[model samples]
Target chain A: MSGAVPWNEARAQEIIDAHLGLEGPALPILHAIQEEFGYVPEAVVPQMAQSLNISRAEMHGVVTFYHDFRHAPAGRHVLKLCRAESCQSMGSEKIAKDFLERIKLEWGGTANDGSLTVEAVYCLGLCAHSPGALYDGEPIGRVDGEILDELASEAQKS
Target chain B: MTKIYVPRDMAALAVGAKRVLAAIEKEASARGETIQIIRNGSRGLLWLEPLVEVETPEGRIGYGNVKPSDVPSLFDAGFLKGGAHPLSIGKVEDHPYWAKQTRVTFERVGIIDPVNLDDYVAHGGGQGLAKAFEIGPAKVIEEVTKSGLRGRGGAGFPAGIKWKTVADAPADRRYVVTNADEGDSGTFADRMVMEGDPFVLIEGMTICGYAIGASKGFIYLRAEYPQCAEVLTEALEAARKAGWLGENVRGSGFAFDIELRIGAGAYVCGEETSLLESLEGHRGIVRAKPPLPAHVGFMGRPTVVNNVLTLATAPAILAKGGEFYASFGVGRSRGTMPLQIAGNVKYGGLYETPFGLTLGEIVNDIGGGTLTGRPVRAVQCGGPLGAYVPPSLFDTPFDYEAFQKHDSLIGHGGLVVFDDTVDMMQMARFGMEFCAIESCGKCTPCRIGSTRGVETIDKIVEGVDVEANIELLSDLCNTMKFGSLCALGGFAPYPVESALRHYPEDFRKATLPAAAE
Candidate 1:
């Protein structure tokens, strides 16, 4: 869950300033910004580049290159279903597809009411417990339709 | 005081270990019982998690799959004193799964409090670093070289030679970089080592720093493993406080400190050069070889990069001597591998044993076959890029060369099993699609060829010129294998090629319906 506070430029600067001392601080700075703002705000990309003495395109490239760095703020909660090999073998694809269809959503889609955002993750390393997911940073294993429905309902309620 | 153990591992928590912990505390309070609960790492018996262990006069008795609801029954049965119960599986050490593992790298993972410095020392943790200091830098490299230790990060490159290159190279400063970006499916050994026994990795990295004369180290952990990141951060701080890290490690007057760097979700960063690029806060694109990461890396300095498992095993090799480790596995692949058995398996978990075990032994005997009670159609021996191994090739030993001989790999020792109902055509298509999505786009063959591969497979499946498309697909695979800059494109064809070679029936079955129509 993120977007608790609106995007703050001053706070983003403070986050950028703190990490600028370290060698190769771009990724860490981006991570901190996302941690506070829920996503890497486009407005702050140029700011970060200016501070780090790199071009905006370079900063944007770095941010966009990694899948974890979101452009817009996610919903109040995020549900990342594993679509990797292990989970696929255990039927995660069907589980994910059914749940998305039931919710009238697609992969990386945020709900209309802004309750949940469903995304596809390659692997969470919970392979032994295949068909696993991370619901707001908590790993849920052996995920089925019922579990997904329950997770969705819980997210909506919260 | 009666002591009870509950796993704090992510897999344990995923299946409601947190709820179980709370329930146990509530139940203990209701019964007016005083209990000492220690949160330890998983025993690698994943199917039996939230495995609750009770320290008895005889040994640690185990209970499998203990839900929160099952807590009261466990308490009523007097499980504190290791009382008899239906869920009880006897002493955990005596369990068939526990008994089978050699556990060189994972010896202390499930046995001790992961973050506690003293618990680490009590369980024989720092002995390797002490041994590293005693033998000095060159001798440490010599020991690792003699151990025949290869990179556990899928490539199977000799780790000692990599270190020796970094050490001998001329540099103002050097670095010990650990590629902890464990993105491969069916692999969690890196996550386990970091979460279970962070000290072992820390110790191993320190040994590398000591050997290579690198004062600084960085562990580029993946963003997916938040728990590992948390545990590793805590472990690093603890190690620093204990004089085992930072300036003057263990009063040895050698300055070696480790900084934890979290990777953004990029699978290619698992590759050494791309990892170095990611560390530099840039786009994670592959670098050409010749001046490998060993010679010049991480801001143009000599770097010693190794996988978590490879580094974690270093301490044991130094302490016990290389020959002790060399004696464990088959030819070329020395020491034990913590093979992760996952996907559709009955007893899926981490199994650490010597090389040379047949694929049949692992799947049928150790794994107890498929979880669905169906025949295993195929098992992908490595990660997503690994070839689909048919049942006919089940006799293939779990060695690097043996797997390579079959156009398969022992990549990170992760085996994702598939049941008989699996569609090989779909699996092959998914392999190409995965490559298309994950390709770093540094090379043409991987970036463009993978998408073409998907289209070609789709055409063949739809009965549209099947023979011609198959030929096209094979040619496409050949080009990607040889033309790609790195393994992302280079090895993406393994599953596709293997599926076509072994399971042509599935592809034909799909085509037959369209052919009739």
Candidate 2:
């Protein structure tokens, strides 16, 4: 059930065979599956387990442990907000509070509207300047309460 | 043929990297000098920003902080073949400022072309990863433990112990997550390494994948580092194409892969557990420990969460041998740390040095004192969440144990200098305010305590219930530190207390005007 690639049996075997007999190879297998199918499907778990001679629970555990590894489908747009000390110094806390309230979602919580999913990020090294936010992985500088509202509204559109 | 590196960091650009690049292109064409113009990153010698290099009779000759207008004069001084220019700081090795630094982790960061794989190989870049891969998993874990590398991402947990947990987990499922969520203030070391020598990160990650038996890795990169993210993506692709990141790297048949997961602006996510939750497509809040990420992390599998800088240093450690890496630092804290010097400083830049230097030396000598050329009133080592170090503590040596003795922790090694003009009142409010904003509101201490602290500080500054408010603010800070779940709440008062202690006058009411705490 991975995006366009379609996680059929043959591709699953290729991913399994790819990481054979290597030094601790869970991450490598995960990377291939993620690449082949935008997300790791349940079906591929058994294949991976069979291929690695491990249990499906083991594969599931590995898949779930990484925040970056997605088992289910993800939306097109991913927005991240700064929660570091510098950004927080510039009133990012208030900005985030109001923005989340407006969107009615917590940090890292995806919108039911399906337009965007917002998450929290730590220092991005833009600290001398603060109250930063990112839209679709693009870091925008000079964020304030009003600016956050505007940005969230923009994300709502996409 | 003479060789030189043109640094491409922002500080270098501000001084004259762009103009120097153009000049080099023009002059190299006109003179037919086979000058290799590699746009490398900074060597962390900031005052020497826009620094140019010349492969000379002696090693690479560096011109400190070159200006575009001064370029012609440098070339005229017979600098083409590394002749001595007036601005030349001599051979890079001889410079006392650079020579003093223990640049093990940052050895090839600013020197090599970030995208050039061959360059990465020539400088012994992937040697550590190669060695690590050759040694197998158990040996890699043992090597990490032997080196005594702690989490550079604030926690300072043993990297070996973390790996061993994952290695020994009963479930066959496992993961290696690189925490690129570097949200501390005054920290640019992560960004610098990401931009300067991206391949090192890739190689480092590959080594992690190999050791943990992890087949896939994810760098939860912050969105603010768009340039870094872009370059990293390109590097991953290049690595994959060359079979370095993809299946069967180095013909070892050890399949490994890496990807970038962009972060939303959330500071709490810098915490490993929060990062895992965020990566799992949920809110970036901290999970209660006991389970720890090693046992019930990510998707409830054994997992290893490491900092970008920490992981990036792995390949180097493996390549050089554990003993060599362990020998650099002071005592229990081993290896070099990248200390970022920022704010009101003449030479505000990043300096990589071994543990155990004094705060005074770093702020005054290496940074060349304050940027305004005035007496430095306060120095904030280790980011905003870190303590406000006073001149009295100037003799305090840098290292984990040393800082712990002084009632502070080195959180990401960012050193921000402030002149006497800084107000403790505003600074205190900032500390509370920062936590208030970034707090995931997972607990009461951070969520409400921060807001309460701000009001208390504001009242004291305004002269209303001044004595009572100070007592209340101090009391609140203690509770937060004691009661808060994460550093976001616990360490929030470091800057506040340090600020209040050093700059009491700034927080005094106009009516009382008492300067001493």
For model 1, how does the per-residue alpha-carbon lDDT over B159-182 read when each residue is reduced to its tens digit?
899999999999999999998999
Indicate the worst ten consecutive residues by lDDT in candidate 2 chain B: B508-517
What tier of docking accuracy does candidate 2 attain?
A: incorrect
lDDT of 2 by residue, B198-258 (tens): 8888888888778877888888886467667777887888899888978798889998888
DockQ of each: 0.91, 0.11
Worst 10 residues of 1 chain B by lDDT: B506-515
Query: i-RMS values of the candidates, in order?
Result: 0.6, 7.1
Q: Which stretches of candidate 2 lie over 4 Å from their true place?
A: A1-158, B14-16, B26-34, B72-78, B83-86, B513-517
Could you tell me how far off, in angstroms, the CA of residue A48 lies in candidate 1 after the best superposition?
Answer: 1.1
Whole-model alpha-carbon lDDT for candidate 2: 0.76
Q: How accurately is candidate 2 docked according to DockQ?
A: 0.11
lDDT against the true structure, per candidate, is 0.92, 0.76
